[model samples]
Target: MFWFQEGLCCLPTFLVVWSSSTFIVNYLIALFRRDVDVVFPYISDTGASPPESCIFGLMSTITAFAGFATMFARYKYLQRLNEITGGVSPALNKAALFFAITSCVGMCFVATFQETAIRIVHDIGAFIFFLSGVVYIILQTIISHKAHPYGTSKRVCYIRTIFAVVAFLAAFPTIICAFFVKETRLHWNPEDKEYTPHLASAVSEWIVSFTFVFFFFTYIQEFKQFTLKVNTELLEFK
Candidate 1:
């Protein structure tokens, strides 16, 4: 009980600190750049210039953290379920583990390249994450359908199909955002002889936003399915 409480407490603290640090770093970048009007892009309702880092940073951070947290919690949950159920589906368990590992690696990349061209790599990593998830679901669906023609509920099968569909759809926006977002180019303005922030054009903002929404839905769907499966099994045993 105490360990669970400690783990829960650490989760929020990690989220807050990481989020605050990212925001402050972005704020500093904005302060130093004369050409960049705002740190974030979408916050300007009054034609105000976008911030140096948009709310996407915050959203991404939250999403990534939530992904990692869900992965962690689900790992333990699945392990315990496997033990209770005389070993849960190995394929499903392995898929969850792979997702968790790749998600963490993606998070590290994002954090490490917050303000550099390397951030583009993070987008590529994200695309891979989506693709991997889609593939995993498709494989799971095929295997489940074959192994348990009538053992698993139709609802479970439907959920897996939905996961693959959504993930594939989401991958497109992520790819667009990765390719379209302008890289920040450092330039010396001859007039002032000072370095300036030449932000990439604003076209990619919508792509980024759409990708966030898509991934958020993906996470919610997976989490819901996992929770439902656990609950159903527990109730059946009871």
Candidate 2:
């Protein structure tokens, strides 16, 4: 019980580090194997092939669940605060939870369905994941700013708001630049017409991914300031 309470504060850090490493390590693997070029590639592109694909799938599955747990923890924390202060309605927190869960579901799809193998499913998943994730963070920022004395400092809210803005800004270009690319490939020549657009899209995606990590990183200290308890009662019949 002591360990559980103590370790709960590290949930945000674990999510940030694990997910960031998942992307970086996969990129390095793909590069080392010559499966992908040194140039920026879509996050999915790095994990679309053999060994890296296997690692990507497994690690990404874990990342998705970790992300969901972090979000759910935040939701529950906010709900408890609302119960005490009555600052925001339960519905707002529920909406944030809904989007966070939806984003994780999308992440699961991205993990299970490799982009090179199932482009349509992968694309759909990417769409859902980024779109829902942006909404989740935006809602979270609002709640953080509005929730009174929830141990959320103004600086934390500002940091979240900045990352939320970056995610929103990067999301549009990730989709728009992809439209400009004629084809999707792991390696691209500088001379190819699709190269620039693909690079733009890829870079934008990396920015958005980093923004998520940064936003979650902000939660670490705030989470440490509070403790949560779960109670379960079993019914007994005589």
Candidate 3:
């Protein structure tokens, strides 16, 4: 509990680090592998690469662990929002927190069931995570706008809103390329051939992931003046 409180504030920022670093590390590792190239888009266990698969699992574990702590911090933001809004709706933040945790759990599923390992579970997890992520962003943006206490100004919320939209909008290109593009390629193995990930899809995926990271990073300003104590589960923005 003490440790959770002490490190809770850094979890979201660390997520940006971990996810981005994982991408770089996994990409570099893939560069050395004979199976895939730097151009692969289905980055999150979408293809058959061992280290990349491991990286996906690692990312899920990382998200869940960090999310466990950061969710509390996120809840506090909502609580403060309630305070500013005269406590008009008590359940809103709670529901938002629930969705945030659900998103983390989805990441866990994606991690545990890599595409090659369990396609059905992987697909389900991906869907849940995607939906949860978008909703979480929407909720957080609302909360941030309302929780104008501490150093969180309306301007901060506005900036966050823009980034959140960027993160959300960035997904469209990837989705479109995924559905419409025919990424057919001859297999390295003469016995078999299959469709590789499209370049547009991969590039769009990068954009989406990077924008998502930036969107979360906007919360650091909100968390900057916030503090939490373990013994009482108390949080305050000084």
The digit string of per-residue lDDT tens for model 1 on 26-68 reads: 5455556543344333211111123543543554556576656
Candidate 3 C-alpha lDDT tens digits along 1-238: 5432443447777877887776677666656664454445466633346766777577658867786567767787557656756532567678778888887888788778866666667767766776677677777777666555544677777887887787578666666655554433212232322233355555766776666677767766556556776575668879
Worst 10 residues of 1 by lDDT: 193-202
Candidate 2 C-alpha lDDT tens digits along 71-179:
9998888887888888877999999999999999999999999988888888889989999999999999888889845667888888888999999999999989887
lDDT of each: 0.46, 0.89, 0.65
Steric collisions counted per model: 11, 0, 0
Clashing pairs in 2: none
Better of 1 and 3 by TM-score: 3
- What lDDT does model 3 reach? 0.65
What is the C-alpha local distance difference test score of candidate 2? 0.89
Please say which candidate is ahead in lDDT: 2 or 3: 2
Runs in model 2 with CA error above 4 Å?
Answer: 1-7, 235-238
Superior by TM-score: candidate 2 or candidate 3 = 2
| Candidate scoring better on lDDT of 1 and 3 | 3
